[model samples]
Target: MRLWLLLLLLFACPAYASEPAVDTLPPELVRLRDEGRLTVRALWAWKLVPAATATAAMELRAMGLDLIGADRAQLAAWVREAEEGTAAFSPAQREVLSGLLAMMDSGDAAASADMLPADAPAAAALPVPGVVDAVPAAPDTVDTAPPAPDVADAAPPLPDVAEAAPSVPGAASGPAMYRCGAARTGVSDASGPAGPPVELWKLKVGDGPCTPPVVLDGLACFGSVDGHLYAVDVATGALKWKFFAEDWVDQPPAMAGGTVFFGNVVGDRSGDRHFFALDAATGSEKWRFKSLYYGVNSSPAMVDGAICFGAGKHVYSADPQTGDAKWSLETSDTVGTPAVSDGTAFFAHANRLTAVELGADAEKWTFRAGANITTCPAVSDGLVVFGSDDFNIHAVDVQTGVEKWKFGTGLIHHPAAVHDGVVYAVSADNLHALDAATGTEKWKVNMQRAGLKAPVIDGDALILAAGNFLVSLDRASGQERWRFEAGGEITSPALAGGVAYFWSEDGHLYAVR
Candidate 1:
């Protein structure tokens, strides 16, 4: 045979005896190889070992993905990142490793091997502040001192350590949870400061938007888009401690019994499923709960000794300490953040609003709306109030699931705040105060916009966090009392001791008296 014919003849020698036929190979892998998903070098090496029988299933146990659907995705990600390692593998992991070793030891010049799951989140907390008596200088411990202002004349000096204030006063004895109290009512019993309030202090957290501040134990706590949950000194605007979550932290941290509960909402499936519990004072993790599908967008609502939240397609109640599931109610569609009132969790799933018992895991009732529900169900009195995509605010009887009233609005995006028999709903550019029982419009005021966030009832004023500005309207009459414009995108105010703490996208946490 000629040189080319001799090589072609050698390549054509297929089945020796014990090896599986080429037709018996996995069609999916063959399809992937044919589509050029695998690299040229990998395909060449795979061809070198014609009898290699390694699979990708047992090798990716650490990735925490749906293994049945993740072989291609995980392998692609690993190869794209140029994965390399010689670390010890678990027994099952070694099963594939042994296969690769046997091929490599067969004197083959190149043998292809899939990568392991190295991107999974470690069980231990990464890095945080105040976990011990002394923490060496690290990313979590930051010294945030502002520079002098730029001005033509003599500028005001920034907050100096020499003139530093005393310790941040503790927020009474009550540990603050998300959405005002455990009920998630968005109603604060205490009043914000009267008149044009003065700026007390501002501290830049991370280079991203922050979750609404949750005040507890002398620390003003919040999560940042920069993947950290920060606890700052309320009095001095100094960084106390921060917990690095390694993922976007959008939801507010709920605190109780010296533990902070928050969620990590990762858009990518790589790290999308953990509800974390960190120590309130130390920033150390207590426990983390996992879920399927998308990361946790719903904030945890602590109620009746169990932490309740709707994650993915299930309504889950976990123990506050161990992160163990107390009860889980599987739903047909996605679920929203739940508000607990009288042992019942009210959440919106697609076009229906459902109520499930927190303790018994029994579903009380489900109320179907005309359109997709856009907001969390706010429970007040005996009614559950929510907004639908059809531009109507529906108030359903909490016990019977019967629709009490359906009031039309221009464009209702956020849930209505119910306080003192009043349902405060915000439309595109209008704020309406209606009777909670009758759904009768009592007052309506037009503004530039109602803002993206839900309305917060602070004493007699209705705070419309109009994106970057704070509009305080008289809750009774819908008259504007004060409108404070922030430097960047601001969130709804979290009131602590007559002070309003606004988390701004400008990376500053503003404390206004």
Candidate 2:
């Protein structure tokens, strides 16, 4: 068969003098070939037609080749072609294409140029004024230069460290700590030069317990069961402004961008609960959203321009400025307050703890705990720590959503507080300290009654709120340093500010010195 085919070819071929020179192709064709626009035949090539088509559109756009002019119909067609071509591109190329499409849609072509690869020849060919030039390029080669001298190495002139003014006594090392919850559970460790000492300026706003006062810009804002949210002067406890809601507001207000956001519980009615954003300075309503659930006990969390909170069995992300719904994530159980870090949101539900990616309503993982979770999950150092109704403290890996370790306490309602590589949790009858890395119990101190709230760590002390008394213990030894009895039963942890603030179940807010 081979011999026959060779004979046939020899007879069929015309007597050509010589082969044509490959370089004789037109300059335009040569340029296209150089830019990888030409295709070659291969035995098993998988042609990504969609990606190729998208690339063709993008390259044309990048080169400022306006094939569709300014006609709306032509532009639509061009965008459709580009969209179809996007499926063929690599993931990185697809991301660039998506960003460019977004910029074009927003009428910011100049901004789209910055998303172009620095090495892209098209970027150099087509310069975008102002916007694109600011993009920094990744270095392709490392520079080997002699190390610069350290600032400390040059002892040119010394500012006498010993002559410097002695540090102020009783001054905080950083910013004044801010706490959340009626018990003031969320306090920052930052302390600096002592501002005025934080005094408990009590105001009789209502008959019921007020939500934890949120301090922002010298104003302390809180909501009461009386259906009113009030902003009081932190210095004098004077009323600045107040806003009324349709129902009870139990959650702490979250302040962001000069606005305060909070949720309300439905009162004897059957419609959506209200979530509102108010002007920080005036206490006027900026925007309000109706949650499609019975009540929203969870406090709103603000990040970027979105407000996040849970109602019923769903967690929602709403625009803080416009009160528009960006996305909603449905959960198996009611969600608690959500804490965000590193583009991920951590939330607790009645039976599970869920971690979801921000900006995209996708679940990273759901950890099922055998009991209900009432407290918010705290995350730090790549670990998530929370307490369950099953009387256990669980620590899980943040990245893989896998359980690292769990310590059972055999009592419900213990809240977990994490600080300095230690998890402090309280059972109804004891305070337990566990290693944050391994969940091993460092020490356990028995109390006479249940501790419904977590211990607050301040400096070297661990403060515990046990039913009717406040106990401060040494952090390292768990030895009781001091104990104070209040007039009524105390269920929430106390806030530390030189002095401490706590609420009694009988509905009185107290400041203990």
Candidate 3:
């Protein structure tokens, strides 16, 4: 009887937010596909471009194009070679070729930032190096010479950067942690700003990439590498309060019922980890739990009365009120944050993505990938989506564990976001929008070395963190609407109440309107 009920629950449908249909490509872009081959060679030049440009000449050569002198004669010579009819170029093809040649002659750098490489470069994109570059450095070595400093007692004065946005009326209460609620689908409940975004203010926090802030009740909360979880006034960019975790706090805190749940890594290798429940009103510790693990970087997901998070190779569900262990499930390797839907909790580790029946202590099913899975699973519309070091974005059945479909990408080190029926995925330098049902490519654009965060859906724009820029693109056509450059690599960003909040690796928190 229980099995039958479980099966019914797995296949049940849930309410989904309304989203528009994917946009068709521009006429010029449509012409690039001729008989299954992309004749726009420059569009695929990304395969040959180096990860970072060193010299203009090297960049051109790396993209499989010649670096010619900036002269009309030189450009004409190259044009003539292509115009002489090698592949029976169509008018559209010829125009694209001319554009490529012109860009090459003029040393256009944006060309290399877009597109995938074919031939030799495509093969280079497939290798899984022994050391995965997207994985951030673990807090391995601890300075044993002196003890760590204490938590901040008084609110630090906000540093001068940009003017803060005017205080807006926020929720009567606080914002729920993670993705607004326990679902963790990466969808923001707060409406995004309309049209091009503008920077409102920036405040320097402790060093290290700041975890995506959890906004609620006019306060934005996040932890920093300098061992502090900070609460900042969202409207004025003022520091509200800070709690020091004696160790590094890389994961965002989960808030529920006016309490915050978070964890920190231990410096020593003894593998002693700690989880704490703090009063949302006061930064005072409410309860603390110690686990025999090295760290807990996974953001906690609150379901039922328990808060679930992953530490090392285990997933622990603890009572949100008392921080007592409810149960623990061991995975093959270290686990990412778990996303809950229906009665299942989804997590990824090593090369396997597994689903556990919450509170039942039973396995639902597991799907294996070709390589390590680093990002958390985003669940919506009866499907789960995640990216892998295997250079593929996978979508799978939420119930039967069937392989629905997969899309090949360069290296998907971040999570994929799904809304309405579209999946937004990032690889190396490209952002792809795929049909959520069949994994068909709807449209794609280059993001110039994209960062490791799931794209946030705001009104009509899909916000992305790309290297040092916070970029907003048209959800339908992948067109750039606006960009805000930062001092360092930007991590994940959060959107709420017409404002987008994010942090950079340079230890600064920014609010853009």
Judging by lDDT against the true structure, name the best candidate: 3
Output the better candidate (2/3) by lDDT: 3
By TM-score, the candidates rank as: 1, 3, 2
Q: What do the candidate models score in CA lDDT, each in turn? A: 0.63, 0.55, 0.64
- Provide the lowest-lDDT 10-residue window in model 1: 50-59
Tens-place lDDT per residue, model 2, 94-145, is: 4533543342234233344454333333322332224321222112111111
Between 1 and 2, whose lDDT is larger?
A: 1
Ten contiguous residues minimizing lDDT sum, candidate 2: 40-49
Candidate 3's C-alpha runs over 4 A off are 1-175, 266-272, 450-452
- Candidate 2 displacement at residue 215 in angstroms: 2.5
Error of 1 at 113 (Å): 41
> Model 1 reaches what TM-score against the true structure?
0.67
Off by over 4 Å in 2: 1-187, 190-201, 267-272, 483-485, 491-499
C-alpha RMSD between model 2 and the true structure: 27.0
Pairs that clash in candidate 2: 51-88, 54-85, 172-192, 173-191, 173-192, 174-191, 174-192, 175-191, 179-186, 428-450
Per-residue alpha-carbon lDDT of candidate 1 for residues 167-271, written as tens digits (9 for 90 to 100): 444233655766677566779865676777777777655644566788866678888655677777776666666666766566677877777788875421134
Question: In angstroms, how far off is 74's CA in candidate 3?
Answer: 51
Candidate 3 C-alpha lDDT tens digits along 1-513 = 999976676567332333543222222223333223222222222222232211222112212232322233443554675477432222433444455444333333344334222222332233332443221122322222111222321324542212323233322254366755556666777866566677677766654446778877777788864566777777767665667677657678887777778887543122246888876655668898875545675788887778898877788888877888888888767667789887689988767889998776767899998766757788899898887656688899999778899999865656777888999888778889999999999998876564535688876778878888888888889999888888787766887888888887655678888
User: What TM-score would every model get versus the actual structure?
Assistant: 0.67, 0.59, 0.66
